[model samples]
Target: MSKHFWQTVGLGTIAGFRSMTAPALLTGNLAKFHPQALAGSPLRYLQKPLVATGFKLLAGGELVGDKLPQTPNRIAPPVLLGRLLSGALVGATLYKINHGKTLNGALLGSAVAGLATFGSFWLRKKTTDESGLPSALVGGLEDILVLSSGLALSKGTDIGAPAGRAL
Candidate 1:
């Protein structure tokens, strides 16, 4: 797979943690730095400032909602589906900007999201159950990680690589 494939995986992983966050960061970055990447494509709407702001609001709400007691499991069918779609959008948009096949990006993004959904859920559950830490606190920490990583990945920063290297 190409570097874009790995990028989709990174974005999808963030979607698994917070369904709207990947798109939030992705759209914001696109709107600010790659407006022309989606020219002539339906996805270009995502580059609009309003659309990016909307996504950011939704992502913030999701982060807060995740800490609520009534929040459903991330693996729930409806919730999981949303996360998958979020990842798909992130992947497709990245691919479009990078001159890759959108469908391929969507597939990789959604697949990683599905896996990360369960993986993050299990990891969070185990840590909470074992360490006696509050789920809300753990989730807050996750929110930090998601935001930091999402920003970097969306900005084409390669993980584990030299500072100047990017995808």
Candidate 2:
């Protein structure tokens, strides 16, 4: 698979853990490094610094919320849908920027996001139970994983790959 494919998959995986994170990181990347990548495209807004900032703020909230006792389950229908959309958005953005089909990217991203949601949830639960770690601590660890991975995947678009040209 191409690096972009893996990057999209990684972003989808990040969405599974934290819904806003992948989009946030993607938007931030576009805003800072590839302003013309989405020119004349509906996804152009993603390149706006304001949009990137907004997503970043939302990502921050998600990070904190994930550790809260009152936060809802990530697999809940509504929340799950949000994660799916988040994955789709970033995937589409990356694919479009890379001259790939947006729908294909969306489908790949959504599918992985769904699978990762359940898989990660189970793993988080198991880790907490087996190690006697607080759920919050485990969630904090997940935040680290998602952020590091998301950032890398987002920046990976620049591996000498041409950004999507007004697609």
Counting clashing residue pairs in each candidate, in order, gives 0, 1
Pairs of colliding residues, candidate 2: 97-164
Cα lDDT listed for each candidate: 0.81, 0.82
lDDT of 1 by residue, 19-137 (tens): 99888877777666644557799988987889989999999899899999999999999999999998888888777777778898788889999999999999999989998999999
Expressed as tens digits, the lDDT of each residue in 85-135 for candidate 2 is: 988887787777787798988998888888899999999999999999999
Top model by TM-score, which number? 2
Tell me the spans in candidate 1 whose CA falls farther than 4 Å from its real position: 35-37, 155-167
What's the CA error at residue 114 for candidate 1, in Å?
0.7
